[model samples]
Target: MDPAVARNLKRRVAAALHRQISDEQRATATDPDQAGLRQRGRALIEEEVARWSEDYSLAHGVPPTREQDRALAEAVYDLLFRAGRLQPYLDDPEVENIVANGCDDVWISRADEPLRRVPPIAESDDELVELLQDLARRHGGGERLLSTAHPTLALRLEGGMRLQALMAVTPRPYVAIRRHRVASATLGDMVRLGAVDATLAAFLAACIRARKNVMVTGTQGVGKTSLLRALAAEIPPHERIGTLETEYELWLHELGRLHQVVPMEAREGNGERGPDGRAAGEISIGDLIPHALRMTLNRIIVGEVRSSEVVPMLRVMTNGEGGSMCTLHARTPHMIVDRIAELCLEYGPRMTDALAYRLTANALDFVVHLTMVDETGVGGRRHRFVSHVLEVAGLGEGGRPAMNEVFAPRDGEPRGVPRTPPSCLDDLRRAGFDPRLLDSPHGSWSAPLQLQVDGRGPGRRPDPHANGREGGAR
Candidate 1:
């Protein structure tokens, strides 16, 4: 089908369906449920498409084919209730990220593949902006605005994807969509994916069972969020848990194993300012943490600690139940402490460097750092694995936190190996961890990770035995 014709038909059918739904709601005096609404929408789409086919046949003496009609109706439905052209990409299990710089410039990053350009999502720049506006209005509960006055948009999509868009301040509207590939993963699942070995997986599960405060640190595009989700899966199902985030990402509430989950997302405010000189209705993650504490949660899991939220998050780890967890952005395990201190000094005006270090050392029990090896430029697949697990002991020299290297990459290997026993090994043992696993310096990996770097040149074929697991979650 021609792109132009498809776009026109989709727009027409979507508009008609919207009007029909509105009329039905007014007549019934009650809105339908989501399943009922979709059923009605699809029925309306079929009727409209049949009518259009009849009219076209009368005008041109040839009706559209059945396949074309079916395709057209599905497209129209997507435009009305889904992500339009982007819905198919989102539905693809292998697609990891989507980037759109304009209507015609789009890029897709998939598992084990180099970045590739894709077809346009919209017919024009204005249409792309309109599409984003429609998405914001539909998914953001009518509270998000995307116009010249408020040109930035951030929200979670239907299946836990995080989307960020920019307009009016850049050359063109830009969008980045990141998918949570392993939203429901557990430690056993992580082991199957080669993200962690069996021994490490058992250790991590024990850490959660022992009620330790853990912080996952990694750079962007690594698997910090996924690891956090897997760690959360170790918590007892009967325990009540609260999750706070700037946007909904971890999605711990969706896991069936967790019985009691309180999920909270921070809200952006209207453009107007209040008497306090802040956005009128803005709600920060920091604001939600204290409120979560008052809810009698057994544990609090923060999505990410990037700003002043670190202040409250550390406090939660200290004052709340001991199993509190969160993620942070850091290049290496050694940099985790410095990163937390920097965020505290920058976002918390009253916080000094010494105070930040003290709080972090006192509140955090362990730091799990993930590493990504992107060899796509050299004809190799991207590999992500846990490379380091640092145990925060206490305040050391120069008022910095002392750390014990529980697990570390050894001899240029990208995967972590057990190095030192944690100071609280007794607690882990009580939680069912085997101390003998730490006796093996190589951990539990069955084989070394095969890579393209063993004397292989750029564009050389990857070894067949190389690990081909899919990349990690957002």
Candidate 2:
């Protein structure tokens, strides 16, 4: 069926359904349940589609096929209750990113596959804007707005996908959706996916168990959030945790594995300024961090330390509980100290480079950096791996924090291998990390990673030592 025809039919049916529901609600004097509303909408969709099919048969001497009718109804239903034209892509488990430049230009990025263009989700730029506005009103507590005055929208969708949309500030309205493929992953799952070897996984799990404040750092789309989820999974189930984010990406509260999880998301304000010269009604991660501390959380996790949030987040790690964790954006492990200092400087006039470095040295125990190699342009796959893990020792020369490269990339290998023993090796041992596992320079990987460009299939080999056995001092 033609996309235009399907879109027209969807619009017509959606309008009719809206009217029908409104009239019913006015007659009943009460709102219908979601299931009841859906039932009525589906029935109306079938009736309208069947009538359209009959009229088209008489007009063109060929009726729309049964499959086309079914497709039309589903599309109408999606427009009414779901993500509309974008729902199919969101349903695809392998899809990692969705980018829309205006109404007709759409691109999709799937796991291990090259980027590809897809059909338009909206009929025009105006329609696309309307779709986004509707979505913002539906999700994220309906407080977000997208308009000429607002110009931008950022929120987490129903399936934990992060969405950012822009209008008025760009040549055309643009939107990007980032999907989390491994939202509920564990350290073992990371090993199976070849993100980390068995030895490195064991070491990271021990770090979590030993109540070390750690940070995961990497560039965009490098699996930093996924690795953070895996690390948080290492915490005992009974402990209470508080997660703070601009949007609900970590979704620890929904995991059901933790006994108690307090998930807090920051809110953007209305387009007016307050008496303090800040946006009216706006709430920031920095505001939420201290409030979370007062909640008596066993551990606090910030989804990402982007800017001013670094000040309070670092203080939490330094003075709060022992097992706090967060993610940061940095190019390399060695740059993490400088990055934190830079963020602190950006926060206000009070913070200095010396104070930032001092706070970092006392706050953080480990820095795990991830790296990604994208070869999809050459008919190869994208590989993301842990490349470095730096252990913070103390304040070093030149007002910077000193770091020991406990795990660094070996020659010709993207994954990290055990290098210098961590200064806190004894603490890791007490938390059940096997010191002998670090003896193997290969880090327990049975074979080197294979790539499609090397004329070999990118098949992951199982870790030889990935049995049920726990690694520790025993």
Error of 2 at 402 (Å): 0.4
Instruction: List candidate 2 segments past 4 Å from native.
Output: 1-36, 61-63, 451-474
> Residue-wise lDDT of candidate 2 within 1-474, one digit each (tens)?
555665576677668877887898799978777788778778877887788889989999998888988888888777766788999999998999999999899999999887799998898898889888878877754479999999999988879999999999998999999998998989998998888999999999999999999999999999999999999999999999999989998888998889899999999898898788888889999989889988989999999999989989888988976989999999977678889999999888988999988999999999999988888987777888898999999988886888898888764456898999999999999999999999977687666565545433455433424643333320
RMSD to the native, candidate 2? Answer: 4.8
Could you tell me every candidate's TM-score relative to the true structure? 0.92, 0.90
The runs of at least 3 residues in candidate 1 whose Cα sits more than 4 Å from the true structure, single-residue gaps closed, are: 2-29, 140-142, 454-474
Instruction: Please provide, for model 1 over 350-452, each residue's C-alpha lDDT reduced to its tens digit, 9 standing for 90 to 100.
Output: 8999999999999999999999988888787888999999999999999999999999987545689999999999999999999999998778776666677
Cα lDDT for residue 44, candidate 1: 77
Clashing pairs in 2: 432-472
The lDDT values for all models are 0.86, 0.87
